[model samples]
Target: MKEDLALMERALTELHPGLYRYNTKEEFARKIADFEAKLNEPLREDRFFLLTAQLLSGIKCGHTYLNPYNQKKEIFERLIGRQTYIPFHFRFIDGFFVITENASEFDLPKGSAITSINGRTVDEIVQGLVSVSTADGDGTTLTRLRSVDLSRENGASYAHFDLYFPIFFPLDRPEFEIEAISYRSKEKVRLKVPAMTKQERTAAMEKKYGKTPGYDEGWSFKFLKDGTGYLKIDNFITWKLSIDYKRFLADSFSRLKEAGATDLIIDIRNSDGGDAGVVTELLRYLHKDPFSCETGIRTFIRTAKADPELLKYASVYDQDLKAALLNGVPKDRYKPAKNGLLEFLNGAVACPETEPYADRFDGDVYLLTGPDNASAAFTLAKRVKEASLATLVGRSTGGNLNGFNGGSYLFFNLPNSGFEFDIPVFAYHPADSSQAKDSGIEPDVNAISTASDAGEAFDRTLDKTLRLIKEKQAR
Candidate 1:
């Protein structure tokens, strides 16, 4: 156990570029030592995973953590593949656990407030879960957003809450003792709901809501009654998907132009980010001038070769790492920079300024941002705000504007327990580094959604944006 802990410490210190970006070396060492102390006795795989997750969360990089999906089949089955999940969908709204979808046989309806689960208060469970959940810097938007997001658009087999809640707060029985306040009558009631396996929960959801669009069909465009074009992009991961995103944007904008629409709303509130190239393509149709996606991609390690000890338990996902290990990191690709960091020279540098698309929309633009907006989506929001390309309406976004760790990754598997954790190899920084590293992109117009909004299927952010546009047009 101690040997594994030492190896993890070494891997993070030697390979992780942004290891100290949010925490000091001394603080990190202290954390490692604390965890090491806990290793005096052997721990079960689940307990070890919980401690490792909590330790990794201190890194404050959203891309870092033990990914449940990446775990081996046996490890996954032992840790997460069980029938111990809350039998309902809920979101944390204004510190309340509001039911968004009820899957249990109980009479609890949507918008009902769940004050407690199994014997723990909602607040206690949330705090415990947040401690182990990964997020960028100190922001909790992504953590909160992920807690209730059951959408399979991101290709996850299970919800975040379903995967983590049981591990963090294990239940001895196969049922959840739920105490909820009714949404319609405001009456408090307690019920013992049977726990559900991933398959059961998925089957229930399908039976209740039917089939929804897959990730490939996550993008759509339509015109509002007021002649406003609404372009909704749920994700930017078009590289591997069947969707031709560039053509989609081009056609959507062309339609808007032909309709003579002078206002456009690009909704990315549900986006958790994807290919930056996709983001750049979308910007060409909205941004007036050429803009670079990032200043540069930086990494602490110059060589892609992994330490043999760590490499034994690690797997390479991208070809870059594989090629580097076989031959070498192409000399022309990276150069040593100041602060002992290696900077990718070719495509990793600030992208060259490409002129806006010939048919770029030259009308009022508004972007809908929210807690789920992250990665390349966050990059879009930052670029739009930095260049004054659009009016950001909604809550603060998930990713930090200062910079984030991504571009490349290193997947590590703990030798003792087959738990897998991801570490982003490179860190991408914005041109302006003055922004707070721990904060997210604040919206120009704040419009928070309530449990009632979710229950009624109303979009408060979009409504506020339309009203704001209407008021501006009235002038």
Candidate 2:
């Protein structure tokens, strides 16, 4: 146990101490001691590892994370263990958990009140859930939920807690009763739900995407007549797969020209994020040279000797210096940097760059966004709006455009406890904006869906986008 504590001290010492400031080092040590004491109780290594991961997740910086903590398949399998999830899809409406779509299992009716989760009221939940401006509060809550897998089996569903918030509440379970009002009668009802395995959940998801123009690699492009286009992107992890985006855009535009297309609607409603390449490519099609988007801060370490206490977590790289700083025998040696290879490798390509477009997109471009449009995708959206290349037509973005500090990924195995945590060491932000981080980019035109449209199977937002295209074409 002493050895583990020493190991933790060594590992954590590599981090910039500005992360958790106290008046003295002894204070930090005491906190660590308290945390260690708690672990001596009910938590196992694996469980502690998850809790540690969740603790790290609280940082909320896009680049900060511990990956391969478990295999990808294993992670998915764990998610499948929960057959039930919060049924209603919510978005922060004037700070309320406004229900957009309520699934039957949630038993909570659409357009109903979401007074509390576990015991934390909606206000309490939203308090810790920052408004980084992506898709409002709904997007904020959902994104946080995804950061750490919270399965019903893990007691997470009923014991609702924010990734960042320390408070814990026991949410009602399958047979548990809760006061909830239905959208139909506006009356309260008690609901019961059943749990299913991961396989069942996957099957259900597969069925959901089976007919929609979805892609296994995670993107979809559908060109419709009347000069309208629909594109659904799942994540912005990389731009290599989207190399054809420019070609597609050009060809689609040409087709639209033939079909007399006057407006383009790009849907990023489900996109989590990718590299900055997509934005670069899209911007190339829209702007001329001398066009460059902001790339946040460039961090660097003052010295290796500054270990544990002084290193303020810079986002820069020094190959030889970094290596030497981390060099040592079994204890002091630094392993490879997690998620820092992109910065470490510098010019080396992590993912293929998207092809630049020679022609700029003209006419009105209506972008449909949600909470899922994050990270690099959010950066792209911010630049688009900054350049006035496109008028954002949907929900707020999920990523912050102003302050962000998550580039270096920190991996830690609790020596005393065997638990682990992944931490992002770098943060960044664009220069020419007053927009704050945690608060996302607001849309120029807001279009949201309601339960009435769902009942009719009508996409009012999509319909509005199409109508706008026609209006542009008519002109």
Candidate 3:
């Protein structure tokens, strides 16, 4: 336990941005010690993992995550039978624990407020669960709740909700003493429901959202009324397709031109970021001038004799750090920071200027953003906002405005517990002071989803942008 904690501290303090980003080193050390004090007796491995997760949540760095994916499945299968699960999933909407979906025997109505679980009030249970959940900058949890795709067809969207509850607050029995207020009848009621299994949950998801549940992963483009081009880029990863992202992008624009599209709407609502370097290709179509947002990047290499293995991973900067590590690196080039992490000589990387595409989009562009926008997605959004390239509509982004901390990652395994986590290396900051510190990029046109917008067939953010565009057309 001590070794694990020591390693964690070393990685965060010496190597990562914890010292630079968070409070003073002394304060962070103290907090770590305080957390360690609670584990007087050695806890079960699973519980210890949970504690670690909770502790890590305090850091609040979006890039740093404790993904216990396989461990979670194993735990669930062991605790309950391979077939047993709680049958119901919930969503927090408008300050209420609304039962959005259930496959249990009991007819638990939708939109019912879950008052309590096993005599514990909803608030108490949520406080415990959410305490372990990590959020970016402001600790605003609204985005976290929305980020969970409760619908099963969306690749275990409810996995977090399911695993954490069962792991943190174990339910031994098949049924819970559920106290819920029905949204329809406005009547208080109690029900005994059967626990569901993995097979059952999957079946339920298919039954609910079988036909085109959610957009498949890739680039999709279509024309709306009046030559309005709608492009929903699910992700930047186009490796699965025969053609690369460049081809897909070019083809998309070609189709738009063929269709005589006058306006474009790029929906990146739940886009949790991807390769930002490739995003410049998309920007080339929109940008009318020479553009570059990356001011400089800082690479922390603590050990002079760094692992040659680390060099296996490449950076956008084409960093050949192995040579520097093998040979004596001159400290004169790098301005030493407060920490002892290997510092790279701060230098600006101006991206190559590209002229507007031959078929460059000359119409109004609207970007749909939300809390799920992080990493490269946030970078694109930031660039859009900075260049006045598009009218952003939706909730604030999940990624920070100032910069990102991801060029490469170093994985560490816990000494005793065998748990592992990744620490992202290289701090990428913006070119200027025009960005917000630790805060996400706010939308140009503020548009939050209303209660009525919840689970509506219509897309609220996109719809809002479309309405505004139409109004402009009418005028």
Error of 1 at 431 (Å): 5.7
Per residue, candidate 2 scores C-alpha lDDT tens digits across 1-475 of 5455455545554553223311145655664666577666675434444444433343344444434322244433343234434433444444345444433356455555445544555666665443211122222554553322222222222222222223122234532233444556767555453433334433443453342222334555667765365566565555346356656556755565565444667777667665666667666665644464454433322123435322233223444444444552222323233223112223122334344354555556777776556766777778778778776877677766444444444454443543444444443433333444446777877777654443345676677777766666677
Q: Which segments of model 1 are wrong by more than 4 Å?
A: 140-156, 290-306, 325-340, 343-350, 430-437
lDDT of 1 at 264: 95
| True-structure lDDT of candidate 1 | 0.78
TM-score: which candidate is best?
Answer: 1
TM for every model, in the order presented, reads 0.92, 0.64, 0.84
Please give the CA lDDT of all the candidate structures: 0.78, 0.48, 0.65
Give lDDT for model 3: 0.65
Alpha-carbon shift of residue 469 in model 1 (angstroms): 1.6
Q: Output the TM-score of candidate 2.
A: 0.64
Model 1 scores a TM of: 0.92
RMSD of each: 2.6, 8.0, 4.2
**Between prediction 1 and prediction 3, which has the larger lDDT?**
1
Candidate 2 local lDDT, residue 383: 77
* Candidate 2, residue 421: lDDT: 41
Worst lDDT run of 10 residues, candidate 1, spans 147-156
